[model samples]
Target: MKLYHLPLSGHAHRAVLFLSLLGQKAELIEVDIPNGAHRTPEYLELNPFGQVPVLEDDGLVVNDSNAILVYLATKFGRKDWLPDDLKSVAKVQKWLSVAAGEIAYGPCAARLVTVFGADFRADEVIARAHRILKLIDQELEQHQFIIGDKPTIADVALYSYVVGAPEGNVDLMPYINVRHWLARIEALPGFVEFPKTAVGLRA
Candidate 1:
């Protein structure tokens, strides 16, 4: 398996971190988004969306970070990572949606403004980050993981941006449970750290 990614991208980090947690030996191919590498025709052939964190398993190409997590979890991990039962699958899918939607527009967008000089309004994104973070904090206060007792791809899906929110000026300090949840994910076996950027509030 090969993962085409950017070092500082939270989306890419989520994929890479989950791959590590699954103990998969995959090559990391850096995509230089800053240098227009992802916009190249050759790169677009792999992912028409021209995004980092595209996965190639043999000849099969998979784009989108959350999709990659589901694919790899189904292919290699135990039931705990991605179950087959209807209820459990839907539960996992819900958080994956959050990771792609709320989390993306929230913490991820906020970080993009500071770290990559993206044009998004920082205050707006930061508020969105807090809204989602508060919801996550409330959810996590009662459950150890997003779905239940065992950690799933849902947890992996939400980990990166939430942990990296501080870099976006979306402080995690007020959400103690969320902070602890981040620590719990860090303590997981085979855990990998997302490369931090000294920007925003973190700067």
Candidate 2:
């Protein structure tokens, strides 16, 4: 398996970290987005969106970080990463949606503004980040993981941007429950960290 990624991308980190957690090895191919390498015809064939973290495994290609997590967990990871039961599946899907929707526009967008010089409104995105964090932190106060006691793709999907939220100038100090949840995820076996870029509040 080959994972085409950019080191600074949380989207890329989620896929790569999940693979590591599963003990699956894949060649890391750095896509030089800063140099417009992702815009080339060859790269576009892999992902028309020209996004980082495209995975190629045994002639099969998987695009999108969350999709890759679902694929890898279904194929190579334990049942715990993504269970088979109806309710469990639905629950996991819920957080995945949060990861894609709320988290994406919240902490992720906030980070993009500070870290990548994106033109998003800082106040708007930062407010969004805090709102989602407050909700998740409350949910986590009762549950060990996002949906339950076990770690799932839902947790993986939310981990990166949340941990790096401070870099977006979205202070996490107020989210105590969220902080504990982050530590728990880090303590999981075979856990790997996304590279932290010093920016925003940390800067």
Candidate 3:
């Protein structure tokens, strides 16, 4: 397996982190988005979306961060991370959707403004970050992980951006349960840290 990624990208980090947690021996290839490496013909052939974090397992290509997580969980037969049952699968899928949707436009977008200078409404994105975070905090109050007591891909899906939210000026201090939940993830075996950027409120 090979993972094409950018060091600063949270999307890429999620894939890499899951690979590590699964104890997979995969080659890591850094994609130089700064130099337009991701747009090259060779790269686009692997992922037409031209995004970092494209995983190639033999000849099979998996794009999108959440999709890669599901693929790995299913391929490895790790029912703990991604269950085979209908209800459990649906619950994990919902959180993955939250990670992609609310988490993207919220914390991820805000980080883009500070870290990459991408244009976005800072106030709006930060507020959005807090809104989703508040719900997540509430959820964590009842369970140790996102879906329940066991840590799943849903937890992995939401980890990076939420942990790095302060870099985007989205405060994590007020979300105590969310903080404790993050601590639990960090203590997991084979866990990896998301590279930090000193920008936004973190500056």
Query: In terms of TM-score, how similar is model 2 to the real structure?
Result: 0.98
2 or 3, which is superior by TM-score? 3
**Native-to-model Cα distance after best TM-score fit, residue 69 in candidate 3, in Å:** 0.3
Compare candidates 1 and 3 on lDDT and give the better one.
3
Q: What lDDT score is found at residue 90 in candidate 3?
A: 94
The positional error of residue 197 in candidate 1, measured at the CA in angstroms, is 1.2
lDDT of each model, Cα atoms only?
0.92, 0.93, 0.94
For model 3, the stretches where C-alpha displacement exceeds 4 angstroms are none
Kindly list the per-residue Cα lDDT of model 2 for residues 1-203, writing each as its tens digit.
99999888999999989998898899999999999999999999999999989999999999899999999998874788999899999988899999999999999999999889999999999999999999999999898889899899999999999999999999999988899999999998889988888899988
Candidate 2 clash figure, as a count: 0
Give one digit per residue, the lDDT tens place, for model 3 in 96-165: 9999999999999989989999899999999999999999999999999999999999999999999989
Q: TM-score of the candidate numbered 1?
A: 0.97
lDDT of 1: 0.92
Better of 1 and 2 by lDDT: 2
After superposing all C-alphas onto the true structure, candidate 1 shows an RMSD in angstroms of 0.9
* lDDT measured at residue 159 in model 3 versus the true structure, 0 to 100: 96
